[model samples]
Target chain A: MANILGTNIISSLGFTTEENFQTVKSGISGVKHYDAGTFGLPEAFMASLIDKEKLNDSFSELSIKNSYTGLEKAAILSVFDANKQANIDLSSGKVLFIFSSTKGNVHLLENAVSEQVCLWYSAKQISRFFGNRNTPVVVSNACISGACAQIAAIRALESRKYDNAIVVGADFLSKFIISGFQSFKALSPELCKPFDKDRKGLNLGEAAATVIFGKQNNSRIQLKRGAIRNDANHISAPSRTGEGSYRALKNILQNIDKGQIAFINAHGTATPYNDAMETQAIVRAGLADVPVNSLKAFFGHTLGAAGVLESIILMKALYGNLVLKSLNFSKQNFENKINISTENHFSDKKYFIKLLSGFGGINAALLFEKR
Target chain B: MNFKNSAELTELYRSLQIYYPKFFKMDNLSKLGFLAAEHIFNACTDLQSAPDCTPITSRREPVEPREDIAVICFNRSASLDIDTQYQKTIQDNDNYFPSPSLFVYTLPNIAAGEIAIRNKFLGETSFYVTEEFDAGQMVETVENAFSDTSINAVLLAWIECFERKVEVFMCLVDRNSKKSCIFTEENLKYLAINIKFA
Candidate 1:
């Protein structure tokens, strides 16, 4: 377990964690419709894409422009803002940087697949951007990468080998990603309605989020426990029984009381299979009565950033005694009896669970508690 | 079982006579890792058994479905080999025909998934992409996996397939075993270096 030092999120909704939280709290969505001619795609789509102009303006404020890619810029901006609040020395080898993304510098593939397309190289560049001396760890495990990277940081901090760990998860929309999702027929043409009766597929979004973990003496927030498990069922499809996700939740929830959990922040991507499968896992884990919410309707699925970004928002809500709503959830389509609401609620609970599932039949759970 | 490039992995699979048809659908990186795991798991049959037990050389014996073995793999390229192929399908708008079959293999962890699907071992599987093969990180990662207490063994691997060349060094680390050589950074480096030369 480690202390929650600082956090930041740069997305289409806003720039800082608080800003993005407030935006979602106000029930404002960032999803926009794009025609086939827009963004060089072959079909109409909808996603929460960060404004290139706003990102450039925010990044230009740094005043030291070495010309990094879009993904790199987002990552640097997030890390810089989060470290500013954490007040840690990044140059020290005791501080490790973990970058999580499904694809890094993937846009470079439009020209050729050079060394620049390597995820590790982009991780190194992001690490060196702050003079971090230790080797950066890259987690590219599809959608669960952000949470998996946090678990990595937790393990590293628990080992006492690092004084602090800065985990940043970032990914941007690209023709490569869009076309692939198009091939899978996984894009929603309108704003996604997660867990609703008429819910279609997921919409891709762009964002970069950071969560700093440190072993401090008087830390208020603690990462209680986390687990990652594989279903060993299929590569691209989720398990029919939600085996991996259930195992992950069961492992992390061991010895913990279900009464203290304020809510379960689910990876509700709005896709038919993902939503149904997630509800199955939630109910199977005995969290059927817990208030669950999905932020996909607000920000779309941010891929790697979804885990960390959503965790930050939920943690903030936990501190504020607020249980945010799962926007666009109209009717219960799935058979699971999991609790989901369209309006916000109040809770004085001290603990929350962040759950995510992704490709490769992998599922991850992170438990956070207010100390 | 040494080959100069990844293209010969199909030949290696054929020569080994492993009858898994899904093997052909995997990308080169997954094929390299899948073949290496096939070799390692075949050599040591009783991974969960006592350390003093003799190693079995069974060809097609069905293995038990264990949930304590984790697949912790490291790679340098991180599926760039397949990413490049996926890129070609969508490079030109007029010629865009992105194949979902090819896009599914773009992740490095899918290789671990392929291994897990075949063995039915579902503990904790993760994939880390390092700039290079660092023995210290490998040893640390294996130790970290063991920290979960439920993970009794790890299928540790350093699978790198890029530029048509493949280099894989996979070993099984059983927490309950003491009869074999010790697991250390130096020993891991030695094995990794030897495999590159082999």
Candidate 2:
């Protein structure tokens, strides 16, 4: 098990994890509708976009001379805040940095195409920002990138390859993404209602979240287990039976008591296929009665940042003895037995599972326990 | 079987008689990786028969969806070739017709997905980006994937395709293989740099 030393999130709701958590607990959503021509898209849509001016001001406060891209700035800001809380020496050779993003510096391709457009270059530049000695590992497995990176950190820590790891997941909204989703007809014109019968589709959002993991720490949160599996079904569509998700859940839930699990944090992008698939997986895993919640309504499916950002929020909620409701969820859409709440409640459990499924038919599950 | 460009890859696919018409829909990057993986899978199971008689598309063996093999690929250009293509579709508002066909292949891991779908591989599928191909890193990643007892074999590769240049070097390493050459940093480096066929 690896200990979670610190966490931070930079999203539309706020700039830190605590702020975002509070905003979520109060049932505030960051998703807002934008008219045509917003972000260079031709149609109107809803998304939770970060304020560029606020981000610039906050990034400038660091007094860094180098001009980093918007995605890099958010990532650095997030890692800076998280490392400040952890107080760990990132420059140490024993520390590893893992950067997770579906697209990094991809917007640069619009006008300029250089070595800087490479994801590895962006990761290396981000690691260099903190004077890290080790080269950063970049994970680009679509939406599962964040969860895969965290799983990599867990294994690295367990294997004693690095004493500590700073994993940051960040992705931004662009015409490239917005247009793609629009073409797929996957964008909902209204606020995304995850797990609700009336749910249409998902809304895009941008955010950067950091999670610091250490092998030796006094932290109470421990990343106990993780598993990644593929359905081998379809690249762009989820499996009808949720085979990969069920196998992932089965792998991590091995030999563990089910009662300790406080709740299941689902991907719940509110896309019809995605929500239905996840429900099938949960039921197949025999955890149908466990209370589940999806943060998409509040975060608007923050792409790569969804895993780390949502994991941090669920960790805090689990430790606080609270179960945050799945916002905007009114009724169950799938014919499975999934216990979803639209109202907050109390839970004294200590364990929680964070599940994420993405393109490429990949599904990942991470089990975290608070001691 | 080293291909220098996409044109040569198409020629290679046509000559190999890979009857899977879905191969036509894949982007250049996916086609390169898919072709490389087909070569490796064929080489392993002795399915590479005469071009005209054997129209091998999918795995000929009747095997269940095996979760024992993992596909881990490293590349310098993470789907930038397709990214640029998708970019052109939405370059301007008047010409803005974002094609979902091109957009879905934007992520690099989709190449691995194509391979998994073709082979029915339910194992872990991951794609990593590095500045350049590093044999040491490739060996390390292969070793890391083995930490999970579920992965019995790993299909490790360094598939790079940016613009006109395309290169793919894939090898399947069975954990229980009693082959002459054991998997090592030196062997991996040598094999990646120099293409030697048995």
Fnat, one value per model: 0.77, 0.76
**Model 2, span A117-213: residue lDDT tens:** 8888888878888899687898999999989999889877876778998999999998888889999999999999998999999999999999999
Misplaced by over 4 Å in model 1 are: B4-7, B49-62, B177-181
Return the clash pairs for model 2, or none: none
DockQ of each: 0.80, 0.71
- Per-candidate Cα lDDT values, in order, are 0.86, 0.86
| C-alpha RMSD over true interface residues, model 2 | 0.8
Query: Worst lDDT window (10 residues) for model 1 chain A?
Result: A62-71
State every prediction's TM-score relative to the real structure. 0.96, 0.95
What's the i-RMS of each model?
0.8, 0.8
User: After superposition, which runs of candidate 2 have C-alpha atoms over 4 Å from their true positions?
Assistant: B1-7, B46-58, B177-181, B195-198
TM-score of 1: 0.96
**Candidate 1 local Cα displacement, residue B98, angstroms:** 0.5
In model 2, the Cα lDDT at residue A105 comes to 79
Q: Please tell me how candidate 1 rates in CAPRI terms.
A: medium
Error of 1 at A347 (Å): 0.7
Fraction of true interface contacts that also occur in model 1 = 0.77
